[model samples]
Target chain A: MALAEPPLGRTTAPTRPAPQKVWVERIPPIWWVLGLFLLTLPAYANDFILFQVFGWTFILGMIALSLMFLAGYGGMVSLIQMSVAAMAGYMVAIFGTSGIAAISMDLPWWLYIPIAILIAAIFGTIVGALAVRTEGIYTIMITLAIAAAFFYFTRQNYTIFNGYTGFNLVVPPQLFGIDWRQPVPFYYLTLGWAAISYGVVIYVSRAPFGLALQGIRDNPRRMAALGFNVTAHRVAAYTFASVIAALAGILLVWQNAQIAPGTAGIPAVIDILVIAVIGGIGRPIGPFVGALIYVLLRTFSPDVLLTFGLSGERFKLLIGLGFLALVFFSPDGVLGLWDRWRARQARRGDPLTGEKGE
Target chain B: MKAFVTRHPTWSLIIGFVVAVLLWLIFAPWTEGMEDVLGRKRVFLNAIFGGVTLGALYFLVASGFTLIFGLMRNVNLAHGSLYLLGGYIGFEVSERTGSWLLAFPVVFVVVALLGLVLQNQVFRRMEGEELRQTMVTIGLSVVLADIMLWIWGGQSYTIFAPDWLSGPMTLPIVSGYRSSGEAVMLKYPAVRMAILFAAIVVGVAMWLILNRSRLGMLIRAGVDDREMLAASGVRIQYVFLAVFGFGAGLAGMAGIVGGTFQSLSPGEDTRFLLASLVVVIVGGMGSIPGAAIGALVIGLAEQLGLVYAPTYSVVFTFLIMAAVLAFRPQGLLGRA
Candidate 1:
């Protein structure tokens, strides 16, 4: 049941007596190229590409990353990350301003943002508390049921949730004399958060807490016998993941300029799971890869479908089929495929020195 | 039951008190004060009946899900799709043939066949991989849901009960006294009552087969220890296939029941899926009687909450689930 990834091991240099310590030299050229391209994308890319596609990808990636944090590291495949995000979205709409004047308090951003994240984190913690009571597969079922409950509750209760219509015009605040919701600003906003989320998750994965969580994932009884509080670690992982999801939710609301119960609907919740699984939950970077693929498919599948004389609405069908194919062929998703390919290539000897490829 | 009562005397007393109060509420004619406090007796009675009938439907859907999960350890997320597919098929059959009874077996067989194919082809390939199987089912459900929507569209469909089951039947229980002191008995939809009766019959039959029959014994043994069952020379795959087909068929039939009680639409699949999940969670996964009890509690909570507190009815169901998970993670009747 403990689907552990390969151990993170550091490689020693063969030619040099001492390992190099330059951080920049340590970073691969591919990362520098990718980072440079992303950083300068707003300069040339259209508003749609910068705002809608990449922004959506980063937001979704962050949420899915939270799920990966749990499923990949904690071995708890929670479907509640989307709901937590939606809860933050709803809290922002309620505490700050929205089209629903009667409901919105119109608080300052400084006040509402913290409050929203806090509330969402609390909600996630409570759900995590309830969910962690069970083990393994039950986690999925319980979280899904809880997620459905949240959706239904939001749809039903009008006083706070504003009923089915939800809140509109829930745009981000204009900060530092700049409209953050603008394409360029929003792109950077989401990208910054996505990077922070990615970095935090990566860093924490190696931290003692994260290592302990992973240990608990592999063997809870053993962890417990070793004096680690298994339940507390699991719950803490949820809280950390929820903060990431809540941040993503706020950014998502700003990106969409509205919030609704459908934001956390069963389909949406399931979509987050699909995104995490399709990308590969084995690594922190996997969710972003999956989200990018998902966003591309979602954004462009309509035209592709239309070319085949099919309706645009068949995008879901396409996604479903693609998902099914991935599940059947590559259970670990695109990342798994990449890993296997890398493994195969590494087995091949280098042409010049006849040495095995790294 | 006697041993349980003796083992937990306090719990037995509390349960006894609650049951006695509920019986009194049902049988004893409400006074004017009582009516003023708790609304009309008819409304209360209707809510009770509504809850019970709804519970019947929940039990039908959830029992199959529990059985499949209990034995196969395959969390078939596509189960809800099977239910909806059955309902659509049932609707199509009943509509074309003009015979409500004719739809049941046809829908059951179709859905059951689909279940067999899935078990044989899809799940068998990923044996012992519970998470992967679940993911596949999730994928299957998404595909099935879209395909169903493509065919049925977004409009809701309700199946009509036959003439024999259509009108409301007056029960002996007095709802209220008329101005002239004449007793006004309770009148409930006959179709609902009949469906409730059918559900009860189905439940009893399943319990009987599981408890009394050899096949049931084999299934139970498999549930307890699959490796042992297979080692004993039984064709465990066939047993798995049969159980899966039966569970899927039962779910499909429940879809028809649900359509009759309410209506079927695209979202109903997810709705019923969540319902079954909550029922299984509360009742204990793989326990039929647990499903029944869980369904009953949830159904009652939903109906009663809807009547008394419209906004928070969902909270009641959720609270019940939360309480169960907190107190007994295995569920109310689940084994530790």
Candidate 2:
């Protein structure tokens, strides 16, 4: 990972395209290059490849980003972010149109989006209030319970949730004479939202609230002694994190044009956790990279295995093994490996050049 | 009110239950048809029976959960995997031998050995580091469950009891607890009775083992002060490892037992794991007696809740756990 870093003034020759080291790190040209490459994918890639693989990957990555932000920064591993996202999805279905044979409110896009997000954030805060009291594993148990409870409530309560078959037919609105559900539009929409989400995480990790959360994660009692309202900060972190997840939830519903119990089930919820951890919970970009790997494996593994005379279900086995290996070897994930690799190359290069190391 | 209830929870619970029972008895006669056909009193009795049996099964699972926590403080999320693995293995054995009775011992040994390897390979390395331990176990569980799926073919399977304990045991009861005290004949499954009996035996055996046996003394000493035990030249690490394996073996045995009680499926691992978590919360993390009591409460509440409020049966488990945690963060029998 460290090997990928720009070794600018070293004896090893560097590529001319390296951006000038600035006082404040500018948005690197590489991001724009990558973004442009992705933006142009719809030209070559089919609708199935664009929407299900790349677009869905971006949305899942966004949801995982929320979990990464909390666990990576706040040190609180919560399991209710999926439930919080489900709340938004359900809200969208209730406030807007759905497949359920009922009178839908069919609220406008602008109105329902904010209201759904607002309700989701409020729901997150309420859950966070209950969860923030406990420490470590207990917190995980509580959030899991709450998520399970919500799943049951939604599944059994037919009147509101439309029973086990959750609401479907939640399509993206044609706000500017363009069907957002179309492959190109959807892909760009997902990419744009992902970039925004990524930026938000990066920005928030440097903010006072984010730093305070990390402090609490390190030692809540010490932080409390320093006059920080530990629970409040933790709860607030949950709210912010939930908002991010809710946005992803809404996007997920839009991507599939439906929401069901399976969308927020235990396995699905755990998958988000897996993605975050696999991506390396240490940095903002980890989830997206992990999502890319996950999406590739998820989308193609079945077909790939088929060519090798293996059954389709082996993909789950592969995913589980992949997760286990990643956690066991590099807890910091792909990003950590990259960092280590870069640091290694830099070390080796320094000695070869006889450069005095720090 | 909260403070008073928290301080005097046991007494308050007893009083509340008595009042609720009396109220149910008074109002039961007014309701007729399907809801009251068995007689509300009889339904309550049946629910209690179901709860007791289910709770016994829960006890079997949670005891192992509690023991591991008590000794190593490692929450083996993969414990559930051992359970299903044992059941699946036991099923294969029983299917081959045409005798379900012989599967229990086989399951116990296999699962125990598996646990020993897991402890040595995974838990031993991440000793006392709860987070990584949890991650490793989660990984193990996912891998194991998938492997089971690959082999078991994702089809649900049930383990059957031997012919001796296969049939239901009919009981005749004359009751006066209700307004109109009448004679009632109830048919309860013998398998349930066996489970309850097994739970009692296991409970007593664990108590005796922990109290009377030298190994138990070492375990107790290890729990109380590992530093002291180690300082005194005892290889306490092996004891913990053995205890972990033993707990795992119990899980495997419970899997076979639970399989007979209910069908086994891939996802059943997580369900049992969740049940064990709820049991741990209510029973106090490391207390065997606490596990027993918690299991009964959860089992009864689940059965009764399914009858009374069918939609909320699953919710009751967490609801009870949440209530216990909210009122007593240390749990009912857990020490602060």
Each model's lDDT comes to 0.94, 0.84
In order, the TM-score of chain B in each prediction is 0.99, 0.88
- Candidate with top TM-score is 1
Off by over 4 Å in 2: A1-25, A350-358, B1-39, B175-182
Which pairs, if any, clash in model 2?
A1-A338, A1-A341, A1-A342, A2-A338, A2-A341, A2-A342, A2-A343, A3-A341, A3-A342, B283-B290
Q: At residue B100, what lDDT does model 2 achieve?
A: 85
Residue pairs clashing in model 1 are: none
**How do the residues B1-336 of candidate 1 rate in per-residue lDDT, one tens digit apiece?**
898899999999998999899889999999989989999999999899999999999999999999999999989899899999999999999999999999999999999999999999999999899999999999999999999999999999999999889999998898999999999999999999998999999999999999999999999999999999999999999999999999999999998998987999998999999999999999999999999999999999999999999899999999999999999999988898
lDDT of 2 by residue, B1-336 (tens): 588589989988997998697556534443446344555656666777888899999899989999998888787888888889998999999999988878988899999999998888877876777877777787788889989998897789998888899888876542224445543456678988989999999999999999999999999888888889989999987998789889999999999998998989988898888788888888888888889888988998899888878887877877787788778877788877
Q: What DockQ number belongs to candidate 1?
A: 0.88
lDDT of 1 by residue, A139-229 (tens): 9999999999999999999988988999999998888999998899999999999999999999999999999999999999999999999
Candidate 1's C-alpha runs over 4 A off are: A1-16, A350-358
List TM-score (chain A only) for every prediction. Answer: 0.94, 0.89
Cα lDDT of model 2 overall? 0.84
